[model samples]
Target: MGKEFRNQLMKVQKQFPQIIKEVRGKGLLNAVELNSKALSPISAYDVCLKLKDRGILAKPTHDTIIRLTPPLSMSSEDLQEAPKALHALLEHDLPEMKKQKPETVSGTVPNVCDRCGRNLYG
Candidate 1:
């Protein structure tokens, strides 16, 4: 199941080479590294917020890597949803994010828990 999830994510990386730097992990723990240069002012936290809106919860680390740690009991169908949501966001939403002014983009680091949506840094 982990391999399948990683493979699916790899396909998304292939589709958006400019945005995704790499998709790598072992077992159910994975990370998608974004090309910060390509993303410009749009940080990984921004991407996480968009992913949350799509019903996918991902955590951003190092401002460029988004971590994926799905539950062990998650079905293949549930696992597939992450990559699908990522692909859709990259395809439709990224362009608009790129067009926004840097001042308009959020610069604060993410403080919310990716799993439960609770404010962790407060």
Candidate 2:
């Protein structure tokens, strides 16, 4: 899982430089960083909301760090779908996310993930 995630996101970085800082972690527990410099200075919280709209459930760890924890029972279908969502987010949403006012974004856990319809907070 880790290798695949790294490969997929790294491919994005190569295609779209300075957007994704890194993709790394142990197993399905991983993190991704964004390059705010690539666009306008972007808040991690804003990126999180953009990712949510893409059907990814990531939370900000800091101003630029996003922690991603896929469920242990996550199926191969979800595993495949997640990266595509992330890629699309990086490709399309980063620009739109850049346009949003920083104060408008929030880090609160979403009620239900757009991907699996799972409640993000218990």
Candidate 3:
């Protein structure tokens, strides 16, 4: 389940190339950074708000960041559901944002920034 969860997270980063700056985790336990610079600059709080709307428990630890730390005994179905919920959070903006980027490396990366919703990195 651990490896599978990690892979799912990595896949999310790839699917939303420009909006996810990094996906790293030891297993089901993971941290995701929403690139706040690429184009849309989604705030971690915004993502969390969306997650809450979806009934997923998550928190923003820094700027444009969130952590997936479900219980160790979580089920496989739960694991599968998580990534999908996260995918939903960014689905609306990613397609257009991806098209706007010029680099294959893509654009993305985030930290919650100020209350005004800026990337903390810049």
Residue 10 error, candidate 2, Å: 2.3
Pick by lDDT: 1 or 3, better one: 1
Best by lDDT: 1
lDDT of 2: 0.71
Structural similarity to truth (TM-score) of each candidate: 0.82, 0.71, 0.71
Collision pairs in model 3: 35-108, 35-109, 36-109, 63-111, 63-112, 64-111, 64-112
TM-score of 1: 0.82
lDDT of 3 by residue, 1-122 (tens): 87888788788888888878888878667888877675344457767766877878888876577888888898988877778888886786445544554442335543654565766765
Candidate numbers, best TM-score first, in rank order:
1, 2, 3
RMSD of each: 5.2, 7.9, 6.6
CA error at residue 28 for candidate 3, angstroms: 3.0
Q: lDDT for every model? A: 0.89, 0.71, 0.74
